[model samples]
Target: MEPGTVRPGGRTARVRAAVLEAAGDVLAEQGFAHLDLAEVARRAEVGKTTLYRRWGTVTALVTDLLEDMAEQSVPRTETGALLGDLTANARLVRRTLTDARQGPLFKAVIAAATCDERTAAALRRFYEVRIEEWEPCARQAVERGEIPAGTDTREVIRAVSAPLYYRFLLDGGLLDDEAAVRAAGAACAAAKAGAFTTDTARPRSSDR
Candidate 1:
């Protein structure tokens, strides 16, 4: 377990939950620049000493918070078809990015990662976990012959969410249902067209 992370059980669970909640709230509302440890402790009603002992620093607290978020994240949707599954995944990403609290929270974290190495690493790990959870959908598609063999499942999953993230982080476009559908459709089309086929699907070095 990382620093500031603990097995949640009974009182320890409650304390961890409160602390992380406070930290997330702070990040969403005030951004990372204002996420003071003392403030988080006060908001959580946890002792300053306890916060210091457990989290040690704001970066560690944020890291643990992200880990907790990933653990608590919703499981992948199974829709039996590649397009259906990708649509579900895209919609989930859209909802999260447009959520009342989660949107700003993610934006703040992304901004923090731009300048903080530890925060950036934690953010990357968070996405990696999410992508792994969703990658199986593409693999299943291959088995169903909906996509070609050697399709890069990870890339397919990433592509589904990439447009949504770009709009959320750069274009500031609305993440509406139509946008979600469009993103999923485009990725599915590309995958079917062999856009994400791995190099293994091509001729081997010896064959060339």
Candidate 2:
């Protein structure tokens, strides 16, 4: 336990916060291939040994960052109506993906996940946590009879976001308030139609 390398008490948390912030900056600016732990240590003003001991590799650092992001995500908006709640979820996704800082950071992580197995798992877990966070809104809708009794709550939540993500990362389409509302409306309509009903899921035809 070297004095400078080993943080005491509250400094451990502070060191993590600083290191994560520096790592995010590197990812947002140049993506993962360019993420050097030494550079991150310099930028974070943390000791290089400490950085190495704590995170070891860029992948580990990014995984921890994703975990923190999932833990700190905004709480679900409870509107008491399926459409209203879904619309809120849609708008929130649009807003986050459009943020100057978050947009690039997310794009970087997504690209990294495409080729890196560990990153892919971390990214998957991040979305799973987020979807679960907002899953309750759809469950409430089910209880209210706004949607079918067997509606897949998490799927309904994912439906509200899938389009916005496509526009942001694939189609390069506009993600405005109108688009959010429309997306939410379509998902809400589909939910009411049993599109996401667990018991009513369509059995797959074997051939592709």
Candidate 3:
């Protein structure tokens, strides 16, 4: 099919969806260095001209993928209890990090971000979007008196995933249910203890 021909539905959207899926597959299996436009187009069964005309560069493609991921990500679940909310968040992270296909894709994207400024910025935005999604859980906890009024909601949300990412990216340790539960429990305890509050004391520089 020609790029100029309009489809019944959203032709541009369908092309973008196909291209991104192919890009993700290449990134997961072959990493960023192997993700060329011509190859992605071939894999996606799309025209190379279409991909080049649309994305122009691999960085743009990756950035667009991240944006799409952020948009399509699951919404947060409310479990009434802060621990329950946190547990749900932690488990979701753990599951993604452990997924056979998704795990490799995430690892590849993170590795690429280290060397590419555009990718790094996109990665940061992706995390910020994810954090924003879950931060409301902490806010709700504050309203319920489960946590302090001045709590840093974003920080609390980060706390739930930090340990899992640490293991997934660095430690190479197990990301089991136990780890997920522990992460949530620790974050919840810290929130309850005012560790995430804006007024939480900081040690003097000399004391460090």
- Could you tell me every candidate's TM-score relative to the true structure? 0.95, 0.90, 0.91
lDDT of 1 by residue, 1-208 (tens): 5578667599988999999999999999999999999999999999999989888999999999898898898899999999999999999999888999999999999999999999999999999999999999999999999998989899999999999999988897878999999999999999998889977695465876
- lDDT string, candidate 2, 1-208, tens digits: 2222233468788888888888889988888889899999999998999878877778888888888788788888998798989999998888888888888999999999999998999999999998998999999998998887877899999999999999989997898999899999999999998799875453345621
State in Å the error of residue 49, model 1.
Answer: 0.7
lDDT of 2 at 87: 91
Q: Name model 2 segments beyond 4 Å from true.
A: 1-9, 199-208
In model 2, which residue pairs have backbone atoms overlapping below 3 Å? none
lDDT: which candidate is best? 1
| lDDT comparing candidate 1 with the true structure | 0.93
RMSD for each model, in Å, please? 2.3, 4.9, 4.9
Q: Better model by lDDT, 1 or 2?
A: 1
**Candidate 1: lDDT of 10?**
94
The reply for model 3, stretches above 4 Å from the true place, is 1-9, 200-208
The 10-residue segment of model 3 with minimum total lDDT is 1-10
lDDT of each: 0.93, 0.86, 0.88
Query: Which residue pairs collide in model 1, if any?
Result: none
